[model samples]
Target: MNGIAVAGLSQNNQSESDIQKLLKGEILLETKPYSAWGGAVTARMYLPLERSQVWQQVTDYSRWVQYFPALSRSEVLHRGDGQSKGAKRLYQVASKAFLMFTAQVEIYLKVFESIHQKTGHQIQFSLERGSFTDFSANLNLQDFKTGTLLTYSVQATPTVLVPSLLIQEAMRLDLPSNLQKMRQVLCGYFR
Candidate 1:
């Protein structure tokens, strides 16, 4: 079980297209490094599972959406040949109330093995030509005394006009909760 506790939820409208940038958008950034272009919100959690066990949970993709909230359904777009090759899976996630839109978000995820021995597994994900332009994460799982530290380093460049800050806030709220839910489900299964 990843001992992750999450609270606070926010809502918003789905206005991703044809929207003017806020004049105050510039002021919103307190610090500016011109190199900072766009994309990504990451969440980390420690779960009570061995690295290998966590890897198994994630690889068993078919059962994920069933346990995760808003992840109403999932389909295996393609399962690669063998142990090391990548497998492609498509996901249909339900829209949240905050977004104020019932969106059918499709995700194409490819699971690959990483060279780092400490990092158990790596899964590459994308929006699959949908509302969002680019969305991906490098999930790293490390061993801990009580459990495992699961960290998701996310990178996403949304094509939609919704403020990047808003998107980041939403992700900050959603990702940790999502992981906590997963931790609970996995813990229950093991128990």
Candidate 2:
């Protein structure tokens, strides 16, 4: 795909069938198929905002599609509330590919959990399925000289049999760019 592939963005416990859980900080956790073998992915980010602003931005998550390479286009499939639990507007997420190299590869199910006002960010998102055998991340916010340092950490297990060295190389090449973009977007938002 030339543009981004948007995914559905829904609430954590909107459905009576959906289970409710409380976790610290802003994060996403889930498991699904990665080719033949199933996997998991977690992603999180700390915004330079008070509790309200963080909630606003996260609840209105379709805005994030603008920066993500895989999700260039996004829309709210449904709507929800910030107070009482409800499903967030879902999105259709797709990957952007480049000839031989696929620019993005991921399909997710939105899960917005509880928010800790004292902590500073909202907890949401979990993978319903995709490429990695495992995908999970956490976003932490700390005091920065200029603003807030939005630190992100993802621990994943590749679904394929790629060598660790190759995977390391890919991370080295991609992580910096991804981090820079995140900083730019968040900084711009706050500034």
Instruction: Name the candidate that leads on TM-score.
Output: 1
Task: Tell me the tens digit of each residue's lDDT in model 2 across 60-173.
Answer: 557766455557656665465756366454444546343356644544545554545445443444445565565555554433222333434445555565555455444434
TM-scores of the candidates are 0.69, 0.53
Question: Residue 1 deviation, candidate 1, in Å?
Answer: 20
* Candidate 1 error regions (>4 Å): 1-39, 82-85, 115-119
Candidate 2, residue 52: the lDDT equals: 53
Residue runs of model 2 more than 4 Å from their true location after superposition: 1-55, 73-100, 122-124, 142-146, 158-160
RMSD of each: 11.9, 12.1
lDDT per residue, candidate 1, 1-191, as tens digits?
A: 13232211111121222011111110001111111333455555556677777877776777777556877766676676666365555555555554766445655655554635654556666555554566666666766445665656666655545666666666656666676677778877788
